[model samples]
Target chain A: MTDPDEAADRRLDANAAAGPLAELFTVDLTVAVATCAGCGNDAPLAAHLLYADAPALVVRCPNCAGVVLRYASSGSTLRLDLTGARLLTVTLAADGSVGISERQPHRPP
Target chain B: MSFVSRGFAGRRRKTPPGRLPPGQYDVGDGFPVLSAGPTPRTALASWDFQVQGQVDGVRRWSRTQFQGLPRESVSVDLHCVTSWSKFDTRWEGVSVDTLLADVVTAAEFAVAFSDGGYTTNLPLADLTGGQAWVVDTYDGQPLEPEHGGPARLLVPHLYFWKSAKWVRGLTLTLEDEPGFWETFGYHNYGDPWREQRYAGD
Candidate 1:
């Protein structure tokens, strides 16, 4: 299986923009399992949490009946090229590093 | 019962499309609240995206210019903070990494402002993780404005909101800013694995 990040990158490379949003909105499937964290004495969490504005869904652990709260990761940001948009400068360490220390509006050259 | 049995395999089962995962992620949160409505026909020809702030110059693109730009396709799971995992969502757009490939930026953090005025801020590392893209198509179809059509940001790793709909433009900054939901009490780094839905999340 492709790592999640790598898979997403490949998708971007292969298709400019496809049906990702619809898939997100499309109600696809449900895995019957412990809904609550306390109820199930499972080794690890089987269900993942995902939400948007408010609580999307919740289920109780039948045994312990603990509430399991799930929400989505708000991954949003801006990307730019040095010539097209504003530019930021910062020192990147030896490790594969990228960071912004300062910024100024970008001007088209 | 047999219908469900046939559809379900292992721990997974089929669900109705266009709706949340039935009992899961279904809170009657209502429409036009968290998501957008369908796109207008005129929107197709008139739609354009503006890229501003922390850049060399303000940039704007008509639907055509956007289409003319380099394109990419990616498939990844959308881990909503709401607790539903939709895997293998295929997206297409200009690779944010590619767009910013040669740009010189000094902003400390980047924020995405959407059409609904919804905003999500995060560190630059997340956006350039070699995966982010300015998504224009979803599943081989043009994105309807209701779904942030014309153009929307696709950050499969984070909650769908990070993938702002009706994404008019982008602004890079040096401060860690908060957005509409973030101000009300949403997590800064909404990681599904950590269950960070709200402040202190």
Candidate 2:
């Protein structure tokens, strides 16, 4: 027999999980943006230009002076068009700093 | 300390290693198994991870986001308080060290809540630079959901349950907050080597 108290506890848990993060967990977003690391163009770019391979990600164009928008994907890695931007790989250093390298391929955010 | 070769590159502790196995701490203590209380079956997509208390911004990530985070590969041995050991567990996901690295908030303790709503607390210092990973894979394959697939906190240095499974989120707190098991007379900081399982058992 199911305990009434256990049933009540389940109800309370159901209510608590109905928050914003609830909806956010199931949906995956995909975004596309442009690259402007070279020539320093300030115009908006398309997603096809900046793609890299890494687990699906929300890429941010670090070269963009301001306005960081999130481009989301679910793939194991991102695909980037390294046309103008110098594809530098950045990793969290042992000391916790951004370690940039040309050896490791640039991973889109 | 005498180390016994566990047939892997790493040596096992003969005197009961002071630290826990990686990828095992995410189950939130598994304390229910020892108690007379109810053990809840965690369902898919019904789990919630909370990042609250003393955090600059309160945030929550769902199963999708948990899976979407940068995936990492780590191999670890899991040592349980019950005296069974599973070695060479392969895990994939963000490390607890990486996940909490940027948070500016300071907390003496960190409490992890699991799907069954079970909880476990650990020291802030204990979470740094260990072979811990929020494991989503086991044995180089996608972890079966029953084994905390999608995501689970991995603290290899502590008891397996400290790695809470079906992990929803982390809550940053200044106080040393205790959760379900700790409140019910389990060890506050469960170290397998020390055999710290029950309260004054």
Candidate 3:
């Protein structure tokens, strides 16, 4: 029988999975730095493992496997959940105009 | 405005009836494996499942004991958050309802902890009422480790991520504690129909 673990590694990372969200953000999400809220681990979004087999994009922390972010789109409505991220730092340009966004706990809708 | 690579253009086909969900495509045959870490090899002799946390007390079952629990065969569609949906996948396992039948608890939520430290949270309500299972087999064969062999949680209603792989035991809690993916950015209440993929959604 084929090793299932090998099959899992065949999956894509956040960088490859970010194709859809590339249009929603001004900066490249793959290049952005993300700090995990759970373990406080820091890494580029590209380093996160991305499972993009469903309706939403699921990005998990490479260090702890905690979720770093999730995004879903339905027609004109888009939902982004970053509850597990402490902060996301994006370098807007090569010139280094940095943008930092803090993730807040989700409120009941 | 979506960019479609020349290679990806031909991958999509006509949607099948009631099989495809919004923002997802059919990946006909063969289950696609996705995991956060290397697959763990747990010997069946040492494998055990537990129910801990806010429950009256922890309940444990060895590989033999778990298999002794009543089992059922289930056929359901699996929708991954990454845009792939597989229809009519079949599995056999013990239902969460049966697993919790003897345990007593007032907890409103659960955190499913797995062998390789993978965790995912779910409302207690979602685990009951025939909504979920701890499956050990897929299509009459023992589930492969990468697909959460020995046992894995199966919550078919939400995205597949919510159905944690390599599951060992569940920790019931009075307060909602976000598990692995939930802590990062995945929606806490991952309802596929609502497309609640992120924190705010």
**Docking quality class, candidate 2:** incorrect
Candidate 2 Cα deviation (angstroms), residue B185: 2.8
Shift of residue A90 alpha carbon in model 1, Å = 53
Residues A39-107, model 1: lDDT tens digits: 333311123222223332222222332333222323452111111112212334356342222212221
Candidate rank order under DockQ? 3, 1, 2
Model 2 agreement with the true structure over A27-81: per-residue lDDT tens digits: 1112112334543433222221121211111123334422122222222322222
Q: Which candidate has the highest lDDT of all?
A: 3
Model 3 residue B43 distance off true place after TM-score fit, in angstroms: 1.0
List ranges where model 1 is wrong by over 4 Å.
A1-109, B1-42
Chain A: TM-score in each model: 0.22, 0.20, 0.76
DockQ: which candidate is best? 3
Model 3 Cα lDDT, one tens digit per residue, B70-168: 999999988887668888889999999998998889899999999877789999999999999999999999998878898899999998899988899
Candidate 3, A43-76: lDDT as tens digits: 8887777767534576778777777787767657
DockQ comparisons of all candidates to the true complex: 0.04, 0.01, 0.16
Error of 1 at B193 (Å): 1.9
- Stretches off by above 4 angstroms in model 2 are A1-109, B1-48
* Model 3 docking category: incorrect
